[model samples]
Target: MGKRVLITGSNRGIGKKLVEQFAQNGFNIVACARKKDDSFDDYLKDIVRMYNIDVTTSYFDMEDEQCIKRELKSVINKVKTVDVLINNAGYGQNALFPMISSNELKKEMQINYISPIIISQIVSRVMIRNGGGSIINIASVSGIRNEQGRLAYGSSKAALIFATKTMSLELAPNNVRVNSVSPGFIDTDMWNNRSEQIYKKVLSETPLGRQGNTKDVADLVYYLASDAASYITGQNIVVDGGRMI
Candidate 1:
């Protein structure tokens, strides 16, 4: 049996890519995503066949705290000890402050901030008992920079990043490392939906002159979860192609 990793939002985009990279690297994966029907099941089957690695799936609604707890409990029961946890399940709704609703704000906070913290708390207990583990929170460049339509989305990510720093301090003594990765303009479903003008502006500002691919983020995450980053913790590493500069 290989080391185990639990990744949330593993059915698509960056999460899906993370699963592939980790599976290729010989990690047994406990992939979590919303139950979207038979297609997701087929995809999981393909992933297991392609990587020849142990793969399991759990369905959960991040907006529902009870569902998150129940689903995570199921994973914990099956894996017993998870070596890595990647909090990659999140969505951004583009709306200016005036257009944003209270419901939207709450949902964003729940999914992007509160849910990850809860998942981390539960997984950290197992990690502590097992002597150590890594927790990586997928933050965003929008969290670091103020954007017009990211009132709720950006605030939620910023909170997650802060939570990562706090978790790192408390979990370090237990050998549980906590860190965050803030990606710039990644060409995922999230970016694909943006307007052409938004895309053009982002590319023009990005030193790389292009959006990053899923593998770009996945590779950095793999490194953080490996023994190579043993001494690293509580840091938010940005992978934005120098866009912040």
Candidate 2:
């Protein structure tokens, strides 16, 4: 049997890519989403048949703390060990700072930052008990950059980035590793919803002059989960096409 990996937001985009990447590489999967998705279910079915690996589906709202714990606990009870956990479910907001409400900020923090930390805590303990594993938090470059119309989303990712560092430090002794992958403009479902003006603006600013795809992020994540990156931890590796530079 291959090592098992648990991933959140596996219904589409980068989450789906991450699931497929690991599946292709022969990993048992615990794929989670906010709700059930038929297309994604079919995709997983194909992966299971192709790889001959175990694949489990978990559903929970990131805002529901108890449900998150309960669902993960059940998966853990069955699999006993998850070699990797990816916190890949998050949303970006485009509201201006002045227009952003406290409720909106709180909501972003809850789902993007706090929930990932909670999930990490639960899974890391399991990793510790199971002889350790790896964790990757899918953050955004907006966390490190002070861009307009991203106050809530940016701040939430910033908190998550910092949490990844702290968690890595504490968990290192237990043979677990934690890192953050900060992606720039990726051509995903989130990108499709944004305005064309924003797209052009980002493209002009990016040194590569093209938007990154989900595979770009997934490839990096796959390496971090492997033994090749065992010496790495607590780093916020950017996939931004030199936008920050």
Candidate 3:
């Protein structure tokens, strides 16, 4: 049996790519998403057929804390051992400070900050029992730098980055590694949803002169979760193509 990895939000975008990458690399995958429809069902089947790796799908909703706890417990029972956990389920809702509603802010915090922390807490226990594991939180470059209309999203991700550092220190003694990946403008559906003007502005600002792809982030994440990064923990590695510079 191969080492097992549990990835949240694995139905699309970076999460989806991570599933494919890890599966292709010989890791048994526990792919979680908020919902599973016919399209995603077919996608999962295709992944299994193409990769020939064990792939399990589960439902996790970051919006509902109780649901998250219940679903995670069920997942733990089924998987038995989760060698790596990728906390990739989050949403980016941009809003200027004055225009940001309390409800939206709370929702973003719940999905981006609170939920991942909770998931880590539960999964870290499993890792501890198994002697060691890796936990990777998918943060964003918006957390590290200031930008217009990003008050809520940026603040929530900033909290997640800080939480990653703190969790690493606390979990290291137990042999579990905790880290975060902060991705900049990745050309996913989320970025495609933005106006073309926004894309031009971001491209001009990016030192690489282009947006990042899902694989760019997934490759880094796969390394972090592998033994190659055995000595690395408690860090936030950015994949923004030097945009922060």
Please, what is the whole-model Cα lDDT of each candidate in the order they appear?
0.93, 0.93, 0.93
Residue pairs whose backbone atoms clash in candidate 2? none
Q: How close is each model in CA RMSD to the real structure?
A: 0.9, 0.9, 0.8
How close is every model to the real structure, measured as TM-score? 0.98, 0.98, 0.98
Error of 2 at 150 (Å): 0.6
Candidate 2 residue-wise lDDT, 1-245, digit = tens: 78999999998999999988999999999999999888888999999998888999999999899999999999889888999999999976789988999989988999999999999989999999989899999999989999889999999999999999999999999999999999988989787788899899889999988899999999999999999999999999999888999
Tens digit of per-residue lDDT, candidate 1, span 28-79: 9999987766887787788789888888888999988898898888878987
Error of 3 at 70 (Å): 0.9
Q: How accurate is candidate 3 locally (lDDT)?
A: 0.93
